[model samples]
Target: MALLDELAAREAAMRWLDERTQLGTQTVTQPDVANFPFNGQTVALLLRQQGICKPRQLDAALSIRTTWTPPGGKPPYEDVEGPDGLVRYAYRGTDPDFPDNRALRRAFEHQLPLVWFVAVAQGVYLAQYPVYVVGDEPENLRVALALGNQQRWLGVPGPDEVDRRRTVERLTKLRLHQPVFRAQVLGAYERSCAMCRLKHVELLDAAHIIPDGKERGTPIVPNGLSLCSIHHRAFDANVLGVRPDYKIAVRRDILEEIDGPMLKHGLQAMDGVSLTLPKQRAQHPDRERVKERYEEFLAVG
Candidate 1:
């Protein structure tokens, strides 16, 4: 019945999460979270019923979570990024003085890091760690969290203001939208590659049909494809492409090249093969975007 000290528990929990998360390729299931080893006892890494979790055993807040929002629904907490590139997390409840909110405030004051569990599906989460509370806005009853220490170098927002703004946008897209995009895409396609049907979740990625940097490249399910690492790289490099009709196309040079079995079976064989889409019709890739990309693929070759 021994409990781990505050720092020990946070560190241990992060190590446990790292084992499960696979550097953003994989997700942590509720079962894994529930069975977290704390000292000699098993403790849940996240709160099951609430978004903000601060178990009595720990002095500061342990984790904050946002559960799966049904299609067309909004998340309980709107974690928006400010102009400074920091992600703002809302207070636990409407009340500004909730104990959980207080715990999170304490973590910010002490410079302690906390885990943020973003749900990809029911009972499944993508864990982002070492999240520091860099800004506390009591007027809004929310705290701003930063994933990178770039804020230290940027400093006080003066001469480099435009550069700072651009940096903020880029950081927001990468740190927040990227992970959620990957999670949603992978989840939509049932964690299998659309081109090859590969089932290694840890080796799979969410490939954007429309590049995320483009104005039209929204991080939504229809604009993404679940792909294995190899396929994702190939797609990005224009070595392979998918037509609007859902057929795959490997670049002519690649198909004709004499290479290892990986080329023959992996890329060439997938040519002209129709994409295996998600079971749910709503999760299917957008045909118009697919066509636009396919036209690029054609012109490049």
Candidate 2:
């Protein structure tokens, strides 16, 4: 019995993901996971029957997936992203010694990277790669994963390491978490723009009501809006905003400006329109955050 080279597998996974991203694919499908090329041959990155994927030739777990819970529903197991930015994944069925769990533990011990397929919708997933199983917490029946180069900063650090850790945190949010955030927010709105109800997933994005740099501006469903790329850019630039009551508001100057069809129809036409929110009230954008953002829009206008 032989295992595939861990480094080669990780490189292949990254290459596969890069190709997908370049093609504007925001979500990974079952077929995408099933027929990936590895080691000059086709290998399944995930299996249909298991969330923890370790192919016969793989010594370490290839990937672990988590599903999106329906609105107001509980997940089979709780996987949490902590304040320190590490994501904790529960072991299989409360058994830290389970084969899948042991493989994950081995991944940590061997410093091998694994893919974490985070569900953006019921069947749609966002693939995050090069995440190392950094901690094997047998006591808690879970393992901790660090994205990209984040594991480098897990231990006690010097002042420079502290700054580097902050950089990694920011990059993790940008390169890894941002896509997951997009998937979750867009999925929450059923892949439609909240303002215009545009349904093109390729053009959609999760806009922050309060920018992520702010203390209270965490990237969660309550703080995000499903917007098309144009609307997203407009919102970010204060050209558009949503009032606390969920009314679309284009900046006064932009509304009155005679620019182009995109401005008149895309932005101005949306002014005074009621925003289309997620059906589940709990998933709606935070009113206070919207108000604060709208105020900034007002100040700019």
Q: What is the TM-score of each candidate against the true structure?
A: 0.87, 0.80
Off by over 4 Å in 1: 1-4, 23-25, 41-44, 148-160, 252-262
Q: Per-residue lDDT for 51-161 in model 2, tens only?
A: 788767778888888877875789998988645556778888887888988888878888877878888777788887767887777888887777766454463223556
Best by TM-score: 1
Q: Alpha carbon lDDT of residue 293, candidate 2?
A: 89
The residue pairs in collision within model 2 are none
Write model 1 residue lDDT over 1-301, tens digit each, in one string. 1223777888888888777776545777766675578778776567768877777667778788878887788887777777666678899877778898988887877766788888877788988877777777888989887664554244324445787767766766777679888888989898899999999877999999999779778899999999999999999999999988899998999988999999899999999999999888878998889999999999887
In the order shown, the candidates' Cα RMSDs to the true structure are: 3.1, 3.5
Native-vs-model 1 lDDT?
A: 0.81
Weakest ten-residue segment in model 1 by summed lDDT: 151-160
Full-model lDDT for every candidate: 0.81, 0.79
Best by lDDT: 1
